[model samples]
Target: MSVLFFDIGATLADVSVAADGSLTFHPRPRVVEVLDSFAQVRKGIISNPGPGATARENAAAALEAAFGGRFSDEALVHWGAKDRRGIFDGAVTSAGPGAGDCVFVGEDPDERVFAREAGMRTAAHPVFTLAAVEGRPVFWARIEAPDDRSPAELEAVAKLDEVVPVHVASDRLVLAMATARGVRAVEQSGFTADLRGQVGETSAFLVRDDRPVAVPVAFAQASAAFRATAEATMRAAAAFAFVSAELSGSRPPVSSLGPGPGGVYIAAAAGVPVEDVHIPGARPGHIERLLPDPALLSRPGQARAERFVTAFAPGAPSQETVDAVRAAVTPPALRAHVARISGAGPLVDGDPLTVRSRDASSADNERVVDALAGRLHELGLEVRRHEFTWRGHRLSNVEAELAAEASDAVVLVTAHLDSTGAEGEFFDSAGRSRPYDPAVDPAPGADDDGSGTAAVMATAECLSSMVASGRTPARSVRFVLFNAEEQGLVGSKAYARAAAAAGDAIAGVLQMDMIAGFQGGTRTMEIHAGSVVPGPVAGASDALADLVAQAGPAVAPDFTVQQLTGAADPAVGRSDHASFHERGWAAVAVSENFFDDTGPATGTRQYHRPGDTLLDRDHDTDYAASIARTVAVAALTLAGL
Candidate 1:
């Protein structure tokens, strides 16, 4: 596989950036030598804003000076900073000769983590040369040692101005900087660019809060293009301050939390200085989430400053102040909070909708959910109504079907209504958060839960069809749509409780999440039947594995299963299946294994984020579909469908 490397800084330029903005430069000689060494390598340079040459107005002259005709202008790939962490995390995921064959190199530990998390070998730059001299004229320093460089670093240094990988981390800052430069950051949601921009040799000058620190206007205007880029960059920086301030979640009125003044008043009234409270990472628009209940402030006969005492830290309460405050402020009566968001009742409107990013909104999966619900409704099956809860939301749980033609055994199949990943809001269109919203940034979702939703819907649809065809099996089938799965297995827990409460005979639970990826055969599938349950359930798990080995090839026609043991623990219980096993329900989850199991090889990278879209370049939904088929086959066989 041909290795891939990336260039940081100017290539993915930071127009108006913070003082800590890191720049990764390549040693020209080492890069050229590596380029020559790999004769059959497919090489290309990916840049943003424009190539160094087009960054300024005197493009032709700058190109001649930098390349001497050795490189063509078309050699550069300009990818503006947008998302962070993934292929653009500056690590090589797929190699040139073939997929999963190459390596990635660059500087920056943050970038390295992003790449490593993406399942790529990463290297950091050990040395850098001074390309442009200014400020005391020639400032020289070697930050990291060359010989001690990591594999990714060496590879990245070798690809500088060559075939360096682009970044994968979110680029809110970089785009802010570009906007400061008067350059527009394209909001494609998730799509590849078709054209590139040109740039010329531009002198580097630092800008702090809109003011040029040391460079002279004479130097900036040495050329018209140079001046325009700088002017535009400065303007963008000024504009970005306002936009960033809005996003930083500072204080209210002007921010999300609450007005800055209101926060200060509340803190002061409590005798706690606003700074002492230390609400880290607060923005303006979301201050209400940080403050105490307003009812506490409106109590009758309470002195203005008396209410603050009760809000102090644990054990620091002043008895005199506390008693006086309690006397002054009467607490509200009869406010009850439930342990689980879901109640043992039917779903209600405005209970909050949960849909998986790739699954819930998927036209294919939506069809499946609808079809199955319709099928179940059509049959004379005695479906029960109950509430299924997860995260902080609730959903309707319906159960029906026979365990056996004459027996009372049961099988459970569940789909989550919540979506995963960063970019799922497009489905709501009415403007709801996908998995993570600006309300809750850093959404670790997408295929992780979204794909699972699809699998459950599909499986339910299949079973519903079978039932509608008058096929009465020996086992009872239960179809559940869970909520708040991303937070933990809360929904499943509620379901288990409800089942135990009603004394329902649940034989086993089969969970299918993120099934739209390859398992075995070429990549091979991994079965996770750890000792989450004991005795018959564990035995059933072993039997289920054998069944997959027997039936998967026929069902999927290719994939195979590699049963795994000894890795199940609290950490393993990331999905709803855990809740079932804990409740003594014979259950096992079938997934894409991700990096840890019999699942996708690249789960860590695109597992979430805007890049986790249907059109992600790396994810293969077709493979995912096949994997989903295997899961369905396994569930049907285990339930003796």
Candidate 2:
């Protein structure tokens, strides 16, 4: 069950005024309904600190009253600095119980940003804030309040066609207007009302075209007491919603939005003598600004072009190197070679490489393992084989080493040599396949880990050459071609177990699962730094990510570097790092950003299919090599070389 965390102030409750001009809490029922619908959901509040604990208590009380007991003392979170780390530390520690299955809600941009950083999805709310505008005070009076009206009401009264004019003094014309239209004004003041008098905001009102039909005023002496009462009464009448409906598309009309401290008036229409006509929902200064146009969806070709351009977007590996890498992976010769080797002859007739974990107990998987082992040896790494009896069948995990050393801290880089086969015979070479084939014998397994394996092999060659040139690695590096990784990180887990048992000081582990093949080289890498790693390990992970950005292809500035340091979740379990992390070690996966590309629903489909041949798409061997070099440098640095 997923847990949801909601912020109280702006999310659930709103501030309102009662009939007596007293402050009150108004809760949004729709929001509460959504919360009530979820059986697996929990709610909480996050608020900023107020004056002192007393202020906090009062705020909490208001929140609780609005939410009907959803909020508690523990649910209220406060931070001195309202920034990312501050927000995260406060929320995580207070609402720490549901970290793994939680999403946070808030209105502040900083709070939403912090929630995302803490590895939670965020929903932003539209909370109200204060806005200022310049305008004259417009008052309103209904015929219902007759004798009750005070002398201040007689001060600025105007009748239709009554020429009432006053000099603008101190930027404000204190005038009273009626709420109803066509009210007769018995002007007691000397100034007469002009029927042609303008009645819009300082700069927004269309007075020439939208002149008020009526405005009434009564003359009153300008005394200190009279001035105060008149000002207060006018302010009270200004509280109605008067927003420009045209400005607020699809929003409801208002008489006057609201008023705040400092003569901050909500937009409203001015009054003329006969009667006052107020346009609803017109906020002050709203007409001067125009809203941006709505966004349009991209055309099909445009989207493709965007993806293509972004893939090769300048930054990262040079175009020449990127092209070179592609040529190596899908070379015509290699394509022909794989076609001839598979015998289905040419992938057009063969199945896509199927990626899957060797279930060990599956008879067919063992045969495939033997064949894959032959292929590995043909490629030149010394293979280490282990076979176990499980359910009356043999399950094998093969490990091959390119370089070996003892007494040196081990840097293990590995990938599973498996595939998922799900495409059709269109991907099959010959008739040797299944319908909607999920797996086939000797699946090319190109991208699954095949690309990874080749990259590893290529990297191994680079390291081997460096070692042979009399440059012994300050730290021993072992590139293990792990079998059965596709089957739940079994091989990596087994390897991690052995390392732990042997008391091997593993400086760090970097796993590359799938790292090749996309149109136009749209390359993205997700740097995963484990949550449970010690300070040093996390620092190393972050440093390595920075190095990759600095040395590899043009990486996007917004490229993701996830620090899984707060809590463990599904993301951490989806790769080989789980095994190592389980044993209190530091491990992280560096792979293409698949999430942003394909929707999460369908995973990389070519995974275990026979069509997982190298010819499937352009491969970036240069990028692969750069990755090799980057990891090599990172390992060297991490191991103190």
Candidate 3:
């Protein structure tokens, strides 16, 4: 008898787990129809449940509630991490002798690779189970009309069989994954842009698509094309997108996967412009994403301040005051802290680096937290660890709180500490990187977050010195380094959840992400103040952003801080600050220039990759200091220092 295994979460449904071990999952598009169609074939599960001892029970309860009597065999339902081949191997073994007779239907290509290794055929979407059973290779393709053609001409793409248009990039561009026959059909329609073979090579892409916009045709069209790709990727179909630095109107596109302010996010050739496939009128831009995040769909955009018709001037703090904050967070000090934590040197005494990936799965995660705690202890600060579980691993959100003489409100300076080298990246088998196995991948995320981590550390170090000198702020300040941030802000989310449960009054949060990357331009910095258009606490978020921008003139005179809020704030809910924002707490994200495409583009192409190490020249300590100082000054000012 033929048996089948299905992956849960994004593959089957969008999931939610209540505090009481109850699971609520909404089936994705055709999940029910597809599962019912395969009634003759025996179905089993190979899925990763939430952390804690009752995770399996929660998943089973949700499964049974959603599709009662569908998955009856308790023996076939295997719940475990699918990051490796062992789980698939066990599933195959349990299914009896003929492994080739079984098929696994899941979303992630990496998971598919493991199943393939277990001698089972794989399908990305449940809709493609027939193809998986029939042994047909499925391809994810981006089809777009020429710059000269209208987007409406490709409407028939939605009508095609075998080709699934997962994301509607634009009227002209559509991102879809299909079988060989579907690819042929799309090519016959006169729109042919085929990515490299298979999905496992690249996790996802940053697609940038807009109208057939005006010049600089060089970069605008590229950016537009990628925007569409980013949308497709946001829907979980990966395609090609360019890093911000490469699409500098003057420079050739450099292909490297990095999360954009928009968040599924993109990779390979150096200096080769991202393959811009179009049949008609093509506009140039870059494709960007965070892995198909529904939460980010309503998040704000990342345009420059100039995009808005109205504006507010920053608070005028004394230059001397700015200088005091700047003096506290120096380039050398920031670099030293970054070097210590980011695998350049030993993290404190006992922690040496074999690899520096703080991915939730890595044991090194705890060591990094302990190292940060050690530094805080040296400054005589109160350190605490809020431990949480994720993917069956124990992780902690490290914190160092400074008490106020008398105040009920608290200000938080935060950054995510976890890193990943494998997500949204591609390395040819012939090239150096031996297919990135998360179990052994190297994610020395020096810039992806080591920069932000260093900034947060420096902020604490400086503030601690001030407090030692008797300049205590009225409001308490908490310096937080979040763990497993790369795993969808797991630590921050937990913190937010607990704080909400306790009714903690958090005034505001200043989140600094990739501050060390300084490519060029007016040294412009972006203040992501969340969105104001329809958000509940837009007014509070706006004020918080203004505080950050006001710091630019005082501390970072050499750098220009373009404050963006309202509809266009790119980081909307993609960063850690979003956690607090969801709780109605005022918050903002500070980072390098990922917006302002017309200006000298700035930011790291090595985002989220193993290349985010201390050895890379992409990190600019001076720029990092400026950003750190900006955030530090704002936090201090808010705390009534």
Candidate 4:
């Protein structure tokens, strides 16, 4: 006799608020099927109703809409913050010791802490509740497999029954909740145990500073604020039904549940070790931005992905057109520009050179902004400072507009002006980089983003020169340098929101962040176009990636552009381009080989470190120029050569 309580939001289903205040709960992938499978066991809810006069009523209405007659026992329907032991204690008491077993299932690790204190087992995701009942300790792990092996082949070799692969993020990357022994079996199957950590992340569960991890998937987000509208919370009975729908489908008679955001939700699909699903007509090489919301069953939207695609539409531009623009973007000019802003050479303002810490708290960040703005002003483009406030400090994002009279459609060339050496690989006890402090640390992020900024500036200068020659493209261009990017992408998010609010008709955004870190002679670079939702216009981010890939062979014949697809693309939300993706705008990121080591070219080892200066040999100027030219040609083609 087992009983369970669950939290809503991301645990059961994703939420959307109608223009009106009414609540609607879209059941996650398999909530109903899983709940029915455990018909023998009692079920209840342990969720927050939010703060408002009618919060409880709103939540109830939505839950009833999604899962009618599922939780019949009104006494077991608990609603309150699960931040303390009191809530879970009440839940345990309500279940009455005779329930035999009790567990609380949710995505948050910190709330799981309170449940443990209340003597109830906790599962991070509903998929792991069965394991929790069976008394198995679940760990979060990242799995990387060889490209030659298919998911079925990897599953057979790993004997996943023993491993119990819970959920997956990408074909190449799987986010699984498995036991230590299961992890060993995975490692034995020749899969790389990229990173592993405990499910709960209180001090006791946190990955210690002494742990030897080369790259952290992420620091503990247990402290992150998980907010939800009052109307979207699905009761526990609803959460289980959807996962079970994915795990054991067609067996259950429940028919109404569709995919919210879980592994494969369709009955024909089982567990996902890889994410291979794509919108119909999307190229196999196309990268789908993995957002919290699933991109399945999508239709073309108002986003002008086709406009950008038609600009650099493959095989559309004549060789003469490509070469004319390509020759104007020289390698020597790109190198000199990277040096000026990256702190490898003289300061653009002639202010005494200091550390180039782009940390939001650093004073030097202002100086970097001045130098970048100054350069743009010198290039004869109309520049504006998009100022914003964060933690009492004033910061600004530089926007340089190159307008055209022919069309109001704008294409953006963007890079972050900030730099940080806060990555811990060099000084932290946790075997990670020490926490970044702006007061003393040097963050000469030349290759990290100086290369990217240089690419944008170089493109701006090239375009300005061409426009002066009466070669203005049909559309306008905006070269934007985002500020406070390292501070959770504050600048870009703000900029995108403003663009959305103003209904800016942006054609596409080409973001270059770390385009200079080519180590091997391979000259390989990556373009990320993954987005979970379609663009606001007719095309998607994939079209923007195609423009870059197509431009590579035409403008920068020396470099190879590899398009990263699915959630595995490391640049998904890690850069400024992600800002535009959230606005339903077509956006893509260009970068050095930062995804993995298996690629032909290598990335900089001094990522986010002071050693990321342009002086570093790995900070390849010629390669940066190649990428700059590719993006320049792509933007030029989009603007119409």
Choose 1 or 3, whichever is better by TM-score. Answer: 3
Model 2 alpha-carbon drift over 4 Å, by segment:
1-383, 388-393, 401-406, 422-442, 531-570, 596-605, 618-623, 636-641
Clashes per candidate, residues 3 or more apart or on different chains: 93, 86, 49, 29
Candidate 2's TM-score: 0.39
TM-score of 4: 0.53
TM-score quality measure for candidate 1: 0.39
lDDT per residue (tens digit) for residues 1-641 in model 2: 33456654334443322222232344432455455554344556555433366556665666657666554446534523344446655566665574454456553334555666676555432111000001122222111223444323432243221112111111122122221122344333322222322222211111101112222245245676566556544543442222343334443222332222112123222111100122332211111100000000001112222332233222344433333333333333333433332322522224454323233333345545555455445545555444321112224455544444553455666556544443324435665643443233445556566556555554454454544555555556656655555444545544554444345566456676666544443445555554332223344444444544553433233333333323222134446654555444456666554422223312234544566665565444434444444444444443333
Residue-level lDDT of model 4, residues 226-317, one tens digit each, is 21111112321243343334434333222211222221222111112011222232211112112111111111123355555555454555
Ranked by lDDT, the better of candidates 2 and 4 is: 4
Candidate 1 runs further than 4 Å off: 1-385, 388-394, 397-405, 422-446, 468-470, 518-521, 532-536, 567-571, 595-604
The order of the candidates by lDDT, greatest first, is: 3, 4, 2, 1
Q: Over the stretch 1-641, how does candidate 1's per-residue lDDT look in tens digits?
A: 43444443322111111112222221222433543454454433322323254342233333334434333333222243323454343324223224443333443333434545655444332111111101011111101222333323322332332111111111111100111011211222221222111101101111112222244557654787576445645443443343334334433211111111112111111111121121222211111111101011111112211221232112222233223222221211000000001111112224333322222223223322333344445544444433321111213333444345655456666655444443234344666643334233323233555455545544555655565666545556666666444433434544554454334666556666555443233645555555433333445444444544454564445555566543332123445665554444545566664525223354324553544533344444555555555655555544555
Quote the lDDT for 78 in model 3. 92
What lDDT score goes with residue 254 in model 2?
A: 27
| Candidate 2 clash figure, as a count | 86
